[model samples]
Target: MTAASRQMKLGAFLWATGHHIAAWRHPKAYVTAGIDIDHYIQLARTAEAAKFDMVFCEDAAGLREANVAIASQTSRSIGFEPISLLSALAVQTSRIGLVSTASTSYNEPYGLARTFLSLDHLSGGRAGWNLVTSASPIEAANFGSTGLRPHADRYERAREFAEVVTGLWRGNPDGAPGHDGQSFSVRDPLDLPRSPQGAPVLVQAGASDVGRDLAARTADVVFTAAQTFEEAKAFYDDLKGRLAAYGREPDDIKIMPGVAPVVAETAAQAQEKYEELQELIPDDVGVALLSSYLSIADLWRYPIDGPLPELPPSEGMQSRQALVIEQSRRDNLSIRQLARHFAGARGHWRIVGTAAEIADELQARFEGGAADGFNVMPSFFPGELDAFATLVVPELQRRGLFRKDYEGRTLRDHLGLKRPM
Candidate 1:
């Protein structure tokens, strides 16, 4: 496909609080992201009009960790439950795919498989599952544990967790197969008929070794925390290469890295807005959250206006560390600056500039083959998302880097991924 016809896939990476930490503080962000059905409908309507691919929602089973103080005063928590919300969204959006988060750690495979199948059927094949292993410390406590399984153990269970799920999704000429496995097993056929897209497209969000294994073995789409062109490119190449070891074709899976875009009429204006957003970041919560994300001690100990200390080596979380270090470097960010910056997009690429400039960067990533598209976390919400779907999307379409119309309805169709049998 040529650049215009190539149709880079796009999806919303929604959090109830909106992507920006202070988003709910914006004058226009709907107060009800916690449960506003109409607000979500508006997003879907706007995205579909842009001919974008899908809308996604992430989930957390635990009370949000950042809700401790001022951030709690914000919309840090809100949204109808994922499956229910998406089910509601499905009726409102005819073309945009619906992808909802479900935890492999918390849910049984047969039930999740059945739920997505039902969502697919309900939405006319527009459903997808964003599988998460539920790694956050807050998430562990929700499940009755004071701490989470070690990273290695989580992915280990995830491997078999996925194997059984995928096995159950297999439609023998007879029906859904029962492949008994170590971590999980199933014996009965799913009574629900195969969805129109077969099964809902499977997606995985972890980028650790175990995360990589599950995605390579079972998911049709994989998401990562890559925030720079280099980091994204490396991840793309690694994943494409690993597909062969999984005995899967490189093209069989689609890669989407998260990007946080802050658009303006000029580079300076975008930067100014970026700065203002950071300044608005509430201090105590932002500081505590920053420390929490990095597993560090009181980061505020460093001078607020001075340089960041060097990041230490880390495993099972290289991508996250790289994002933090490089962003602080690129922006020459101070402790205060870094704190607010994270509020905007949580360390994703913060593309700021005119429409053409934003388009240029997005197009470069697409051309470089680092991403099939993106999980766009708009710097703010409603307005920011509206700006993206309205202004930036049209510019991309005019340049032929994005689709003018969706040719397929399901998330699988949007990603050029095949439905599982």
Candidate 2:
């Protein structure tokens, strides 16, 4: 597509309550959002009505926080399993794509491949999978593993897992000799037919060096986090640059960084709205969140007002750990300050502005080659999503930066992705 015709893709990243740690406390936020299928149905319909490319759900096998007290303080402890949730939504919403996170760490390839293909057919090709190597020790413990696998080992397993899943989705015949690998073994092809869209769109969010390589090899869409234009651009260029080696073109993969926008009619209102939520965050909750991202324990033991202590490499999310440390050092922020800042959007880029201002920043990133699109993360559910759909989406449409209407039925058609041969 030509530059002028290259409209940006948007995913409505639907998290429980909201992306903000303190979102459940917001008077307008839906406190029961995690269990309310009706709430998710409403959220999905809202995104579809706004012409978003998809409604994305993130999943974890276990509770997010190990500390029972900390876990109880947040709404994250309760939520529908993403696959079942998306399946119910498949029948509820007609056009928007339904994408959900699933981990290679805990699931087998054939079952996962079969499950997503079922969702694809159920949605009439409007399905996608965001692949992740489960990074949390809490998740590991739930699966009865001795401990968390090293990061490299997890990715190695993921690489093979993805290969098998894609192979099955691409029509590996039922009686064929199947995969025999280091981490898994498969005896037969999936019982289902090929996905209605050729295959369910493969999405990945790992941004480490190995992660980038994995994405280049397999992902049709990449969801990432970047706090700056420079960071986004560099990641975009590097990942796109790797396509050649994989015998794929740059256009084959869509790189969408996560963007959290707190938008209102006026800048002051937006800022006020943001600060209101930030003020609701208990310091301990924020610190626990920061500690999880850092892959460290007892971050609370440090002086909340003091500088971050030096750290070793993380066996968790390496890219996110680096991002946190970089921000802590770059801004000379104390633990309390950094935790509060990151707690709002969990380290994704945040924009507190009027509709037009938010559009300008998103336009800059898209037009400047820093991103192909964005995964829109609203601070709170319903209210914040409603605000963006009403205020920002129209502004984007008016500027011709986003689609005014759906051009086709399937997610692949909306994304202009090539069908598998």
Candidate 3:
């Protein structure tokens, strides 16, 4: 079927606290949930209840924080390893796609391939890989390195790594026994049978130029944070155009942006709920972190309400840093407001309204060629996500905007994506 023919796909981007920076601080969401396997289990089941295509988990290679960032930072660190957690979920939940992020910069390709291959087998093809070339400085030191890898260079390495991984999978047929044994080098392949999909679906999330090229070559799905119609359509057109160069079709890669919704019965209630959640952010900390991400020194150098600081020439984190600064400048957001906004990656796109209203925004993007689907990060999870599943999902189903029930068992099936051989 053509892109125009398929219904829009939906995947929930699950964080330990549930997307909002202070989600765990919420009254209903389990603050202790990040470390608990049951938290993810509940989340996966919730998503399946909504007929969402998958549940995606973002991972980082290095430790984020020891005490504060570590203890409270369920997202960047200190959660069950994604594949392991998802493996457990595979036994409990049947339909939702399980996506795990693994960085190409810090990991060995052979190891990652084997692990995800095992997950694919275990989940019966409900597995998807969210490929990331991590952009954190803190992660470098933990790996016995002092500096972050160059951005473009990371993508270059990722392209090669993907080639090797997929090549390893190329020999294995779906549900058939086979092995290359590059890591173990054992010619006999008897441990586990071949996975149902042959290989896990490849998903990538980077808007960088180098990132885009790698996605065109290796990814079955590409994720971005663009939310607006014009931006989404432009990216969709540009990416689809590039696929032919890789000897692939435009339909081969699907583009999705992140969406965070705060839904209530009334628009006023939704906005109020979002603001209430916003109040929990730490102002000074956000300013410091945001400034450092853009490589600016002393965010305290500027007033809380002052203009965003100009960043230095790009060393490695180029367009990414510029985007944040430029967004700050364009919106004229203060540090406090910015922090609250980033409570859920503020710039990604926030839908504040009733379920019908939120559905309208989603439909607009899909019809406008802005998205093949969305990476939904809820504002306050478990409860907020529960609201989404209970209230908003039916509205989407009413409009034929999302799945009323899962069509197929595997992640690829839910996305209307064919498994790549």
TM-score to true structure, per model: 0.92, 0.99, 0.90
Worst 10 residues of 1 by lDDT: 313-322
1 or 3, greater by lDDT: 1
Q: Compose the digit string of candidate 1's lDDT tens values, residues 149-239.
A: 7777777887777776666566567654766666777778888887788767888887766678778888888877776789889888987
TM-score, structure 2 vs. true: 0.99
Best by lDDT: 2
Model 1 ranges with Cα > 4 A deviation: 1-5, 174-176, 296-318, 326-333
Which is the winner by TM-score between candidate 1 and candidate 2? 2
- Residue ranges of candidate 2 with Cα displaced over 4 Å: 173-177
For candidate 2, the lDDT comes to 0.94
Best by TM-score: 2
Model 1 pairs in collision: 4-400, 34-78, 34-79
